[model samples]
Target chain A: MLRLIGIGLNPKKHMTLEALEKINDSDEIYLELYTSRIVDMTLDELENLINRKITLLDRKTIESEFLVERSRKMKVSLLVPGDPIIATTHIGLVISSIQNNVEYEIINGISVQCVVPSILGLQNYKFGRSVSIPFPEYDYYPESVYNFVLENRKLGLHTLVFLDLRESLEMSALMGIDILLKMESMYRKDAIDKNTIIAVISKAGSEKQRAIADKIERIKERDLGPTPHIMVIIGSLHYMELEALKKLASFPENENINLL
Target chain B: MLRLIGIGLNPKKHMTLEALEKINDSDEIYLELYTSRIVDMTLDELENLINRKITLLDRKTIESEFLVERSRKMKVSLLVPGDPIIATTHIGLVISSIQNNVEYEIINGISVQCVVPSILGLQNYKFGRSVSIPFPEYDYYPESVYNFVLENRKLGLHTLVFLDLRESLEMSALMGIDILLKMESMYRKDAIDKNTIIAVISKAGSEKQRAIADKIERIKERDLGPTPHIMVIIGSLHYMELEALKKLASFPENENINLL
Candidate 1:
């Protein structure tokens, strides 16, 4: 039987007991690192924690023929960061398992989309369509993200912007800031003004996770001190939300005046 | 200091180590049951597992004056099911804390939005705005939810429909199916016909969690035997997604023929 186990977003301890049990029960364990990464622990740490030698599966190994065939014969546990099915690639694996007649089970994990709003003091229902800003390819970046944020602004909904990260390379919060800044400029010149509120959340689900709220320019200039960050550009704020932004996020005094 | 901690969508085990730590560190833990209920564990079960006594908070306690004053003087943790900020009431509390000058922190949790796509074989990025279908009020149900789903269909984006739950009741998968059936009639008479794929996810993030995909009418007729469920009305399906839906969701061959 094939198993899709969510290793969660933070570290080894973030995994559910049932997920851990499934990992221990599996004959072969494969870890996928492309979609999301564990911030607090290493492969060695996970190995030690789970007491099993795990084979690290990159995108190629997962999509390859050998792994697919092997999964059918053995009880294999494919560990994914965050929830297993969040990425389309993993969904493809499940589909392949179906075609191959491999029985499988999926174990859920903590998702960053749920984590970001809580860390940033934004309402989840108030959020619009989430957009991921990937590295610009050949001076061609999608304006759909900008349009989404603008639409959210029109409806007074918050926008959660997930930044791009490569498996081999570390992508920092600065990348997210740069994308937001560019998007702001492309959408509206005064978008980064004092009245604007943006929350920079880094290392979410990790022990050292940091969430700070400020104007777009200030957030851009500030050092959030980590890779794997998400930004929330808030639109309309209720009286309580405005206050939470001020206290938890350190909203500026002048900004508070306008909000009040 | 006031802290809003998300216990995730399922059970006690779904919480991250950091979230667990925050819950342990708090002087008092208040759980708001009106907005959402934990499908996996009871308050007593959580108390025994976490080794802490949890105080239950109603809507009045969360919105009234006592919580604000109590939060300021003490380290308070407000426990929520799913992500803390997903519900409007939690956002109101965060705002209240800010207005009262209470220092606060948000401990993130896993949400169903991130979980649904993986299990149901839908694209996370291809989802439009999420809306809730409240129980009929004064013989007039809002068409806003229908419009949202219709718009999502037009845009080829999936719509996550949250079924209404009574404040004191446990809402399970069967309720979700009922809502889907209601929605199908409202949108299109033939919408509930065979080949119309709808995913009914119940007790997500918990060991007892279950997901099934079928026609809206069939799903409604079947006894799903659980609560706290959501419905996903799929739009355009990718090849892999379609396969996953068929394999993982147990779609009948006749249903596939209907789609063709």
Candidate 2:
């Protein structure tokens, strides 16, 4: 039997009781962290809670069939960060499991997509399709994200931008802002402008989780601590939403003259 | 101190350890079921788990300062269904708490919005603005949901329609489909037609979770069973998503000629 468990944002506090029971039952447990990062959770703490040693599944090991072989022999659990069971790679593995007739279960986690908008007091219903800002490596920069924001803006819907995270390199909110600014310079479609206001959420779902809103230009230079941050481009704002940001975090709503 | 605790989808097993710990620590505990529902969880089970007397909050009492007055004195936990912290009403309460000089914390949950897409194996990024179909009263049928679906279809984005839930009424997937079909007949828009394919998810995130996909006309008469069902009007089906639905549950892919 194989279980794909969702270990939420803060591993120690956010993982559900059901997830904990599954972790305790599994004979072999593996944590996949390449897709996301847990800022507050340590392996020692998780080990103490589950009372079992967890093997880290890196890019190389994940490519191997150690997990599949173990599933055939014994009960195995693959822990993914922030509700990744639906991810393409995980879906492929599940399909493989079904073809091989290996039973499996998906324990849903507290997805970051759900938490970020909520934490910032933005109505989740108003959000359009979310986009990811990939690290511009090897002179390759995808302007698709700008197009997404443009499409969302056209409909007066908010866009949630997830920063890309590579091996040992987590993109910060500032970096993501820089990329968007650069994309704006290239496209010049008026999707991203200096006068436009955006929300930068840092260390989301952690104790240090913070939401800051300001003009695009000012927010681009702000250093928002440890990585795995999310940036939200505001297409339209309700009065209560702006007030929520003002009350909950540092939002320079008054400074953004282009909001109108 | 105040804690907006997220008691997840299934009351029996979905809530996190952190939520339980906070519930134990708080002097007052309240469960707000107005926003969402836990299908299989009983009040007894929840109260037994936390070992505290749980108070229920409805719309009438939620508007009062009863919670605020209590929070000013001792630690309180407003246990919300799914994730209530981001909820507008909950945010209003939190704002009042801050004004009253009360410290609060937001504990996230396994939101249905996130899990439905995950369980259906649809990429989370493909979803556009979510729509809610209010239970139409006498001569109050709203066609806003059709507009949402129309807009999403324009961008080839999936529309997640949340069926409205009232105290005495729990809108089922069948009812939501009926409303949409009624709208299509009234508006004569091509957005929702007999040929449109949709995915119906019943009791999502629970042990008895079920997902089915078929044409609109076929699904309208299909009895999905129980309340609190989510309907997804698929835009562009990715190969992996269609495959996941084909493999996981009863999805009549071939029956829909218009799917091509």
Which candidate number maximizes lDDT? 2
Interface RMSD of each: 2.4, 1.5
Weakest lDDT window of 10 consecutive positions for candidate 2 chain B: B251-260
What lDDT tens digits, residue by residue, belong to model 2 across residues B118-158?
77878888899998888788957676777888889878788
For residue A84, what is the lDDT in candidate 1? 81
Model 1, A1-260: lDDT tens digits are 88888877875546775677788889998898988888788899989888999999878878775556887779988888877877777777777777777787877777777667666666666676777777876865577776766666665667777777786665566666566567676767343455567787777777787777787657666667576777787877776666666666666645643331
lDDT, residue B114, candidate 1: 68
Q: Which structure among the candidates has the greatest DockQ?
A: 2
TM-score of each candidate? 0.83, 0.95
Candidate 2 positional error at A255, Å: 4.0
DockQ list for all candidates:
0.50, 0.70
lDDT of 2 by residue, A1-260 (tens): 88888888787887888888888888999998887877677888877867889898886676566677679878899988888664677877676777778888888888788787777888898899999899888967687778888889887788988888888787888878888888888888888687667888888877888778877767756655666678888877777777777776677646433332
lDDT of 1 at A113: 72
Best by TM-score: 2
Candidate 2 TM-score, C-alpha based: 0.95
